[model samples]
Target: MCWEAGLSTEAGNSVDPRSNGLFGVYVHWPFCAAKCPYCDFNSHVHRGPFDEAGFVAAYAAELVHFAQKVPGRTVQSIFFGGGTPSLMDPRSVGAILEAIGRHWTIDARVEITLEANPTSVEADRFRGYRAAGVNRVSLGVQSLREGPLAELGRRHTVDEAVAAVRLAQSIFPRTSFDLIYARPRQTLDDWQDELTEALWMAQGHLSLYQLTIEMGTRYYDLFRAGKLQMPGEDLSADFYELTQELTQNAGLPAYEISNHARPGQESRHNLIYWRYGEYVGVGPGAHGRLLINNQRHATAAEKLPFDWQRKVLARGHGMVTDDVLTWEEEGDEMLVMGLRLREGIDPRRFQRISGRAISERQIAELKAIGFLETLPNGFLRVTDKGWPVLDAVVADLAA
Candidate 1:
């Protein structure tokens, strides 16, 4: 199972101190009440007959293992993402948080976020999660319309979704919800009205994702069979424009393509990803990007629940893949992730990591083509015209 750039046990726990920065920890709980038809994330539906205790122990073991490698680093944030992290016992969540505190230095104002579904079953645990150290909750209320909800294969109703938001607002210091638009049979007008209504209820932040048919998902199967009829290109473009206008007018401009936030209210955990900072991902199917000893690496846990659990129990870690990145590969990733942020990437930072500068020739070419703009901060950012054609621009630059 080894690949190029793979690290072995003999490499030891030594890591390059130059890799240090604002590090965060991500814990994945890969179980849900039901699997949504469109979801390709490593999530599974579980009935009764599960071993929650064993899973928690395995998770703690994985955390301890990484903490050893990243000792003395301050954790700025911790995110509990999922299949549905709300399915986890609050006690387990508390224990994991305690373990993190014990293993690593944590900032006094560390942001801790937990992802929850809007279903009452999950919502009922919000207060407990808050008590257990979760300060922010991102609810998966993917749509407010009953028809759209059903179409998206969600388990919660509109009323339940609203109630969940209300409940979360009451419990957590910060709350946000997700909404997916650009579905089949949806028009720009419909999306405009829906997004408007959502903004009215949104306290400060929103995650507006366009419905994408990913490979291996049921949605993709239906789409390839010509059974899924989504909005046409023109309609989707209108929806995107409407989203920007509405959110901007609402004073919650987009910090990322799918995320909007008020001044100083962006999700810090997500910022770590967009800024290409280091993080440790623990859980089945979780992926992590780390910089150690001046080498950037990607880490992936075992995808299966039993296998991950067994690996952690045996080796005190669940990572099945830990591979370093080549210089070209790292530069390509920098371009892709950096362009996702509105702030863009600093050219100096890029040069520091990649050991080479963005070619002046390429910069002049991109600027002439109107795909990039030089910010006052000396960062190269994608222009509005470049956003819709981002894939093409990234491809060209990477090439």
Candidate 2:
């Protein structure tokens, strides 16, 4: 059961596996000031005073748990994501980081990103986060318009978000912000104006996501009740096209489906995910994939915040599911995650990992329809034309 260096070995021997050479840590801070209507993330609002110290301790313990499983590895990236990572006290962040450092080798140039809500309150902690070793900060701006901000259940005003972004730019070495588009009654002109303003304000990275109505979210109920009028498919396609055009012109092209970034400014933490690299997810409701003894194992933690903490305190880890994936499952996941990137996936690498070759006939069919193309270096990627029907293209290829 040697996980030293996380080197890959043959199946069931447990002699460490991570030969692809990238590893990361995802820390989910499952607490938010308020949950948005369109949000389906594992976030909750705990009224009144809560035991923050208990949670921090639990996080540290969980890090230790993962560290044992993947010991002697160099962590390339660490991401602090929702409910609102910015809500954590700087000391809590430092404690978790310290725990990671104590158990594993940290990369000299590791990218540490913290996802923050662009509120005046959280913006004040930007300096503290930086001082505590956070180099990148992604603000959840959601929108640039006053109306959309309110409609999205965002507590921060447009002005506040802007100010926070400015402050973050001044404080953090790297800064990225998010904006949701194709909202109810939103027109192309409206989006053009807002995205233009965002582009003007953007320094390096922007996460422009289309509004998706997930099954359990409030927006889903509204949509089913005929109260929410989302943009039609044609309009949605226009939004995507315009997004690519504007961001490309700004030198911040879409690196992934929803994320646009200037060259070298992409979120390395996210890249680890899209590249299908090894990583451990700590905190409530976080999902992770690791190359354990050459088998890709998917892990998920308990969804409830306090319940996760209780499990961690009692058993040293809150993980509730750790399923070893079959070769076919691994292959499908690799394609599913890797194809989201503009750089695409390498068929040879996929074959090496999955014991299956990507179908040449399927590739030909997709290419004939202009949905797939082979890179000069032989990487298979989805094209701009294909991106619109990416799900269908992937399904056909996977099938």
Best by lDDT: 2
Give the per-residue lDDT digits (tens) of candidate 2, residues 7-46: 2232221234434677889999998888899999999988
For model 1, name the residue pairs that clash: 16-293
Give the TM-score of each candidate: 0.94, 0.95
Off by over 4 Å in 1: 1-20, 120-124
Q: Model 1 over residues 177-217: C-alpha lDDT tens digits?
A: 99999988987878888888899999989999999999999
Clashing pairs in 2: 7-16, 8-17, 29-83
Give lDDT: candidate 1, residue 3. 13
TM-score of 2: 0.95
What are the Cα lDDT values of the candidates? 0.83, 0.87
- Give candidate 1's whole-model lDDT: 0.83
Query: Which window of ten consecutive residues has the lowest lDDT sum in model 2?
Result: 1-10
> How many angstroms is residue 219 displaced in model 2 relative to the true structure, after the best TM-score fit?
0.6
**In order, how many clashes per candidate?**
1, 3
Lowest lDDT 10-residue stretch of candidate 1 = 2-11
